[model samples]
Target: MNIDRDARLEKPVITANMTPLQWANTEKYWTLYKKESRISSESDRTTHSLTCCDQELRDQLFSIHDDIFEMNDVNMLKRIKNMAVKSESVIVAQVNLVRSRQNPEEPIRSYYARLKGQAVICVYTVTKK
Candidate 1:
């Protein structure tokens, strides 16, 4: 997917449900995703992680993955999960949306972790498919 000169290039299909802020957050992160996709071409470790986890774990991971960096000081996977669990939010549905760069068939899952009063989202990676 050479996206250098094609301004009208069709964005890949994805199944994701995100709020305005979450969508904006993803917009910022997409720059990193695009760079990684271009440099590695096919090295989507995070995407693979999301794809491989069982639906249950994938749902759990998605909620934490999306806003981990913002929620926590460090990006430790374990700590991120712990942070999510501590929030007491029920893991919600998986979103159906494609990464802007490498559009995979399994749209990355976007989980909405809604606690007693609020919901925060995150996109879980499929470390490998």
Candidate 2:
């Protein structure tokens, strides 16, 4: 399917404060949209992805990074993911993970899955020192 200007496709808006899982979901959704819409052109994909991002995110990218407008879709998405995993956001994710709990009526499997999702944002590493 060539680019359909009239297609009622809702793009996923990426935000500056989005968590790792949220970012992953956004990327997945974008991929699905591309596949479903049969959008193969790199330029079209990049333009659509960037246009879906929130204003703050777009501004931040434009300010700190040069040649973003020339970037391909994969590179631009990678840059956005990197920005989201900064120190401040990681700290916030750790705090959220620490405070996470299952709701009263939630099942064990669902609770476990939720906790796992929350944990994805809290980067874990082992120091060789």
Candidate 3:
């Protein structure tokens, strides 16, 4: 397996995902490879499938790739539609908490400021589409 000493050195080639790549090889991993012969690890399955993704998809995925183990695609999709991707979920949840609160005893200016900050956070988190 150690061919480095005898192998010829060549220039490395960098390939970019210029074209759209769909997840078309699921059958190979799910049915063929792991059907009975071997059990594939979570990391192996994730990396293998990601290799077929386009650049845009890969970049979007990279942010939460490490947290892939805890990711729920259904919930993630809903968050994305709301423009609350990743850390923005905190702001959204906070806004809901504030909105549910009854009138609190506070100065008029401070109360308005709090509401305004929450408004801004909500506006940005909501996706137009």
> Considering every candidate listed, which one attains the maximal lDDT?
2
Candidate 2 local lDDT, 21-122, one digit each (tens): 877678788887888777899999888878877888888888988999899999988888776544447788789889988899999999998888777767
Q: Quick one: best TM-score, which candidate?
A: 2
Tens-digit lDDT string for candidate 3 (1-129) = 334444443321112322111111222233443334333665554443444344555566667556644545344333222222223454564667466543667877866765655555454455686
TM-score comparison, 1 vs 2, better candidate: 2
C-alpha lDDT score of every prediction, in listed order? 0.37, 0.80, 0.42
Tens-digit per-residue lDDT, 1-129, candidate 1: 565653542322222333434443444454454564442433353343233234555565556567633432223323323422323222432232222232354333422222211323334445776
| Candidate 2 lDDT score relative to the true structure | 0.80
Candidate ranking (TM-score, best to worst): 2, 3, 1
Relative to the true structure, candidate 2 reaches a TM of 0.69
Per-residue error for 78 in candidate 1, Å, reads 4.4
| C-alpha RMSD for every candidate | 15.9, 5.6, 19.4
Error of 3 at 11 (Å): 24
